[model samples]
Target: MSPCTLLLIACLGVACPTLAGCDISMERQGKYKTEAPAPLFADGTSAQTPPDDTVAQGALAEEQAAQTPPPATPALLARGRERHDIFCKPCHGVSGEGDGMIVSRGFPRPPSYQDPHVRQATAAHLFDVITHGSGVMFPYAERIPAQDRWAIVAYIRALETTHDLDISGRPSPRTAGGRGS
Candidate 1:
C-alpha cells in the first residue's frame, strides 16, 4: 500500500478509539457534561417529540370535517363522471355495468356495481379500492388527485343508487357505502 493510504488507515484507527468516548452534550442547567445525543435520522433531522397544540388537536379534526365538502356533491359527481368515463369506462363500462368494450375484447370481465359483492361494499371501501385498486386493476393514486378520488367515489355511489335493483328483497343503501343512515 502507498504511504499515504497507510497513514490514512492509521489515522482513522487512532481517531476511532477517541471518537467512541465523545458524546453530544445539550447545554442545560449550566453544565458541559457528556450526554446522549438527540436521535438523528440518516436524513439529518432530529427525531424529537413534536409539541402538542391543544386548539389544533381536537379542533383541527372537527374543522377539517366541517370544511370538507360532502362526499356526494353534484360538482364532484360530474367531475367523477368525466374521469370515470375517460379512465375507468374502457374496462368498467359507461354505466359501470362492468362490461366495457375492453371486457368484450377479452380484457376480462369487470365487476358490475349492481352485483351482490359490490353492493355489500361501503363507500369508504369503494374509495379505498378505487384509490388503491383491486385485482387486475392498477392503482389510480398517480392519475387521480386525492379530492378527485373522493369525487369518483361519489360518482360510484350515484351509479349504485341509480342502477341498483332489488334482489332477494334487499335494496342497496342509497348513501355512499359505509356512511350510516
Candidate 2:
C-alpha cells in the first residue's frame, strides 16, 4: 500500500531470488542444441561421429539372433510370407517385384527384388534396408521386427530362386498378351 512497501516488493522480486541461489543462470541456453552449428568442432557440427566399434544401445547386432539368418525351414518361409504380405506386399508386391498395389495406385515403384543386382546384395544388406529404409521408401524397423525382416529377406530370396528355376519344371506364366492359366 505504501510507496516504500511497493518499492520493497519490487526489489525483493529481483534480489530475493538471486540471494536464494534460484536465479536464471540454469536457464541460460547452451552454446548449441542438438544438431546445431559448432564453431569449436573442426567439422562445424555440434555432434561428433562415433568412433569405430561404437554401437548404439539396443542395436541390430543385439536384436537379431545371428547376423546371418538360420535355416529357411518351411515354418520360417510361411512366417516370412505372412509378414511380407502384411507389411511389404503393399509396396513390394506378393512376388517382391516392386509392383505392389501401392505402385499401381500412383506411388513410386521400388526396384524389383528379383533384379540381378538385388539378388547379388547380401542378406545383411537387405536387412539394413528394411531396418533403415532405402531412398524414397520409409523404414519398417518398427512395423517389422528384426526377425520378421530376416524372414522377408528369406522370402525375397525364395522368389528370386523360383524365377531362376528350370522353365519346364514350372508352369510358365502367360505373357502379357496371352491368356492366364
Candidate 3:
C-alpha cells in the first residue's frame, strides 16, 4: 500500500474505537420499561402508587365546591350579575333572551333562559353546561370558578322567575298561581 493509505488506515484504527465508546443515545439508556419489574424497589414494580388520600394539586377544594351549591343570597346574585355581565352577557344577553350584540353581529344565538325546556332544567344541569359547555358555547370552567358558576345558576333562576311574572309583578296566567283553582 502507498504510505498515505497506510497512515490513513492507522489513524482510523485508533479513532474508530474511541468514537464508538462516546455513544449517548437515549434509546440505549438504562431506564426501566413501563410496568416492568423493578428489582431495586420494594414493591418490585416500576410504577409507584401515590400515598392514600393524596389528591392532585388544586383539585380537592374545587371538586368539593363543585359538588355542593351554596344557598342563593343577594350578595351571590350581585356577584352573579357582575360575572354574568363579564362572561355571559356577550352571548346570552342582558335579559337572558339570547339576543346579545354578538347575535346582532351574526353570531349564533344561545337558547333563551325563558324557554320552557331551559326553565325546567335543574340548577345542576346549568352548572354542568357552564363547566363543560354545550352545542356552540365554549366551556367557561377555566375562566369562571365553581362558586361563580353556582351564582350564575341562581341568577338565571331569578331571571326565569321574573320572566314568568306579569308587568304588575303577579304570576302570569300561564303559571300555577294564575291558573284556575
Candidate 4:
C-alpha cells in the first residue's frame, strides 16, 4: 500500500470510530423521487403500471367514473370546451375537424370528431385515448389531470353529437379496418 494512503486510512479508521454522534443509519430510506427511475423494479421504472385486476390508490375515482358517468350538464360541457381548446385544439381544431393549426404546420392530424367511429365511441374510449394516446398522438396522462382528460372527452363527444345526434351503435369502416376512412 502507498504510505500516504495507508497513513490517511489509519487516521480515518481511528478518528471516525472515535468521533461523537457520527451515526449513519442503515435503516434510513433512499431519497427516491416520483419521476426518477427505480432500477430495483423489473421494468426499471419508478412508476409501474397497475396489475391487471387491481386499481391503484387514487384511481378508484376513475374506475367509478367509468361505471357511473355523470350526466353531461352545460357546465361540464363548458369546462370540457375550455380544456379541449387548450389541449386538443392544436391538433383537433376548434371544431374538432382534424384541421388544426398544427396540421397546417405539418403535424400528423388526429381523426375528426365527426367521424362515425368517434361519434359512436364511448366516453370511456375517449378517456383511454386521451390518457394513453393512439397512433401519432402522445399520451397526455401526465400533462392533463384525469378529471381534465374526462372533460376533454366530454367536449369531443359534444362536438360529435352536435353534428350527428343519430350516430350510435354503427361501426365505422375505419374502425373495422377496411382501409376506407
Candidate 5:
C-alpha cells in the first residue's frame, strides 16, 4: 500500500479503540438492579429492608406527637385560635360558618364546623382533615406542625360545642335567629 494509505490505517487503528473506550453510558456505572443479587450485603439482595425498629430521622418525635393530642387547655385553645385566625379564618371565617372573606370574594366555602357531620367527627378525623385536607382544601401537613394541627382540632371541637349556645345556655341568634325563619 502507498505511505498515505498506511498512515491512514495506522491512525484509524489507534483511534478506533480509543473512541470505543469513550462510552459514558449509565448502564456501565456500578449500581444494583432491582431484586438483583447484590454481593455487597450479607443477604445478597439489592433492596434491603430497614433493620428492625429503625425509625427514619426526625420521624420518631413527629410520629409520637401526631399520635397523641395534647389536653384542651386554655393555652392550647388560645394558640389554636391564633393559628386558626392565621390559617383558617381566610377560608373558614372567624366563626367557621364557612362565610370567610375568601368565600365572599368567590372562593368555595369550606364546610362549617357546626355541621352535624363535623360535630360528630372524632378529633382525630378533624386533625387528619387539617393535615391531609379534603375536597378543594389543600394539605397543611408541610405548613402546619402536628401540635398546631391538634390545637386546631381542639379549637374546632370547642367551636362545635359552643357555637350554638350562649353563656346563658340559650341558642344564639346565629343559630336560632332568622337563619331558618
Candidate 6:
C-alpha cells in the first residue's frame, strides 16, 4: 500500500474507539448497561435455593437440642458397632473403659463413658462432641459420616450400660514383680 495511505490507516486505527470499548460504555448506560444491578439472594445464600422440603431445619429455641435419633434399626446399631470397633475402640477400649492399647503405652487416657456425667449427657451433646471433638481429640467432622457418627454414639451409650467406673476408677498397673515400679 502507499506510505501516505498506510500512515492514514495507522492514525485512524489509533484514534478510533475500539468495538469492545464501545460495547462496554453502552452497557454502562442503557438497558444493556455493564453495571447491571447485583442479584438479590434469599437469606443471603449465594447459590440458588433448593426447594422448601429438602432443606434441613435447625433446632427450635424451646425444644431441647438433641441429636435427632436414628431409626432404631438393627442395621444402624450394627453399623454403629462396626464404626466404634474400628475407630473408637482403638483408643476408648472395647468396653469404653478408656484403657485402650494406646493408653497402656504413653498416650493420655480417654475418659470412660460409664461415668455419671457421660451417661447423663443428652444424645445431642454426644453428637456435638463426637462431630466436633474436645481436648486431645481431633474433630471428626469430615472423617466420620453424619449418620455413622450417630451410630457410634449409640454404641457408646450401650457401653455405659454394662460398666461401673468413675473419673478416678482407672486401675493402677502393678509391676510384674509386685513392686511400685
lDDT winner: 3
lDDT of 5 at 91: 93
Mind giving the per-residue lDDT tens digits that candidate 6 earns over 31-109? Answer: 4223434355434434454777663453242122233567667788789899988888878888887888889788899
| TM per prediction | 0.53, 0.58, 0.65, 0.57, 0.64, 0.53
Candidate 1 lDDT: 0.71
lDDT on C-alpha atoms for all candidate structures? 0.71, 0.80, 0.89, 0.78, 0.88, 0.70
Candidate 6 Cα RMSD (Å): 12.7
Q: 129 in model 3: Cα distance from truth in Å?
A: 0.3
lDDT of 2 at 49: 85
Off by over 4 Å in 5: 1-56, 167-169, 173-181
Best by TM-score: 3
The candidate 3 region of ten consecutive residues with least summed lDDT is 172-181
For candidate 4, lDDT tens digit of each residue in 34-72? 879889998787887877888667678765654554677
Whichever of 2 and 5 has more TM-score, that candidate is: 5
lDDT of 6: 0.70
- Compose the digit string of candidate 3's lDDT tens values, residues 77-158: 9999888888899999998999888999999999998887888799999999999999999999889999999999999888
Clashes of each: 2, 0, 0, 0, 0, 4
Better by lDDT, candidate 6 or 1: 1
What tens digits encode model 5's per-residue C-alpha lDDT throughout 1-181?
Answer: 9999999999999999999989799978999999999999999999999989888897888878999999999999999999999999999989888989988788888888877788779999999999999999999988988999999999988877777787898887767862221
State in Å the error of residue 112, model 6: 0.3
At residue 91, candidate 6 shows an lDDT of 82
RMSD of each: 14.8, 9.2, 11.1, 13.0, 10.6, 12.7
